[model samples]
Target: MKQDTALSERPAVGATPTGPDPERAAPRYTGGQIRNILIGLMLAMLTSMLTNSIVGTALPTIIGELGGQDKLAWVASASLLTMTATTPLWGKLSDIYGRKPLFQVSLVIFIASSVAAGFSTDISWLIGARLLQGVGMGGLVSLPQIILGDVVEPRERGRYSGYLGAVFGVSTVAGPLLGGFLVDSPLGWRWCFFITVPLAVVSFGVIQWLLRMPAHERTANKIDWWGATCIVGSAAAVMLLLSLGGKEFAWNSPVTYLFIVVALVLAVSGVFAERRAEDPIMAPRLFRNPTFVLAGLASLLVGVSMFGVMIYFPQYLQIVKGMSPTASGLMTLPLVVGMLSASISSGMLVSRTGKWKIYPVAGMLLVSAGFGVLSLLQVHSSIALVGTGVGLIGLGLGLSMQILILATQNALDRADMAAGTSAVTFFRNLGGAIGVSAFGAIMTNSFSSGFRSVGAEAIAAGASPDELAVAATGSPAAIHALPDAVRELVLGAFNDAMHHVYVVGAPVALAAFVVVLFLRPTPLRSHT
Candidate 1:
């Protein structure tokens, strides 16, 4: 296979090429070769995504054994902070060094950290291991998309991206069920961490054996260390603020103000450093592209709806409907099915037509509609109604998720491919983090309000205020065990709280739809 000149060469700093070289063409691979490489990449993605979900399901068991209840939230927060912070750095490094080697390094890091996590003797140890694993997970998440941009034409990339989306959907569904089984069986929660190790190892081997790409040639090897540091620092500060604001410190506290100041300072420093560096981590030039800007904004907003629902919907099932965790997981099958179907079908349609804008436009609309539908759910809404609302949300996500990245890649110069791809991913992640925090605050306030209203009624009915308060804050099982009238009041409060969350989400999704409308539909490129 002949390597394209674009693949081997980097544009000089601040140079903007008008378009791809007409005389040069991308490296060609047989369909089987592409499929084989995708198999390895998908395995790597499955390993990364599955581990996060599995750990989420097993957290209760882990806390029981480790006895660090105070540190329980850090187990997840540590990884997310690192992963989001390092995402762009991995992409920039891949653009400088080449994707194959950096991806392999990430696999090694993930595998090692997974082993460390499984062997952890305490909560602190597990959090440390998870933080390390997140650095690797960042690469696993972003590099595959960049690599795909390198090997496949943007016109045909959707078909393959859909496959990756399917892998994500499967992992989302399988991880919790598998984690529960492990926790209940003699294998225990440790196996949740241990199980991903072999899968990642196999993926590492397969990528080594099958993945090949041309090395990137650069005129200078200077790294923008200052820019990287500031970017990471800024991202970490923001994440910490969002993760801990309402829980650990008041939103108006000095800690919150300190984090805000640190983030802003680092962010300003990063921008200035990028403008001065010989080789910037996130090039300033990419922002000039309208496709990149709009796509990134749309992705950020879509992420708000996506993660907010995924986090809160299960609470509705368990708390309001009194379903167990395992049963709630099963009930989400409609969402999985809708996502898988929409992703694969939309990808195929885009590949066949070479036109991509309609899907996202329609997708965001459906997401807004889904939010509206979900807002209508009540304490005793039928199972079918709940499924319909979630299914709509899943379908909307499927249609928009990869397509935004695809549009951004298609619009960028080959030299900016990795950085541009990572930028969009970073936005999506940042949005999810922000959405989770903001929506949680909203839920807390709404729940409080609902509880007070219902508490007044319970008091009038001769229910003790202290018992009502305990039931309001208690676990789903505990709430279900309350007296019938009090239980109804608690469930009603929860249902109203969820309604408020979804109602707010609907407008966010609609805002994303409005953003998507401004995207200029550039024709998909036939070659990388």
Candidate 2:
């Protein structure tokens, strides 16, 4: 790997270089110090990402025991809602108070919430704990990246970003497996919450010990309380609308319109509050930066593609292929492997070359192609074909995910680092939230239509209406239990619905590709 001339001349170990702008440049750390700091950050990141997904496989057992079948989805939605709402606030707070203290506070909150979640005697308690956990999770997700930008120069950031990406990929794969294993073992489902406690403690200790950075000297000490309120309220409203809109109430119902109106009002108020605040939660200036805007747009679109497939593919595996939850997770290993490989490799390449546009460009193309391949999947499609489609999607995501952040961080002024990083993250997460809801709505509609058509044919073929209805509304096991002829028709209907999902996703990926095409190719800076 060829090193940039400036990077090659970096200050010797333990020496802080006062670059052209000492105030803006991060404290130069020795390689060992950087490694130690990253270790703590990675552990915290692992805990955060793992918490997001680990509950997935255990939800069934949770509902079975807690008896909140109707409230099952809130187990996931509660966390996501709070996380999204609080992310920008956490970032701004970090910028104001300092990263170390805020980060440790988040860890403390996370640990306490995990313990609370583990002790939950009812679904409501678990949901409340999860919501608190998400508030901490918001910091865990954005702070490490912000801190990384603070510690490493852009030219070398890619190499470390790759490591974070690898951790993300690992956590994504491990969460479901760990959750399933815990549920199956004598330890049971609660341990899923307990298991991360030790990791969070270790991470908290490590960060407190090894991570040290120069304090930021702020121009203003005023907290943007009104801006924060508006931002949080707006985000929470939008998240609630997305999570509960089609399920808890009809899309055209008064409740849906109320949520929409509340979201818009809060959002509009947030923009005005940000513009008028002494220290805005999400700096209004970030919107003026073309790189931030373009990167955020691309990130949002990528989020749609990424989360839509992640949430639905397992269903295709379990519902159509008759795989168990564990088996479905195992089947997605190809996607994780491809993502891990591409993320690490791309990060290394960007570090070496200090060029990143080509990767996301290629990545979006691959993602578009991946969706095309997946759209062709049939009820009897081979495992190899399924692997190929998901693997392609994973590789594309790996190539693009961290690079977008890298690009945004590189373009931002030092003062805007935390707010900018969080904004990009906010967009990606918001996109995921929107995509999941939208795709789910699409799947529901398409499946209902296909199931209705198939039911007519099955009834004509002498299948009972009650049995067909049961299969349509019941679990995968219920669907598979139907007679051979009816089962085939139901599975075909499901397969077609999934096909429609990927087909719709392909254009979204292409839109991301188009958005990235307009991103200005600012060279990665050699100084922090």
**How many residue pairs clash in each candidate at the backbone level?**
0, 0
What lDDT would candidate 2 get against the real structure? 0.87
Note each model's CA RMSD in angstroms.
2.7, 4.0
List pairs with backbone clashes in candidate 1. Answer: none
lDDT of each: 0.85, 0.87
Q: Candidate 2 on 232-264: residue-level lDDT in tens?
A: 998999999898888878899999888889989
Per-candidate TM-score against the hidden true structure: 0.95, 0.95
Model 2 lowest lDDT segment of ten: 7-16
Looking at candidate 1, the ten consecutive residues that score lowest on lDDT are 7-16
lDDT of 1: 0.85
Which structure among the candidates has the greatest lDDT?
Answer: 2
TM-score attained by model 1: 0.95
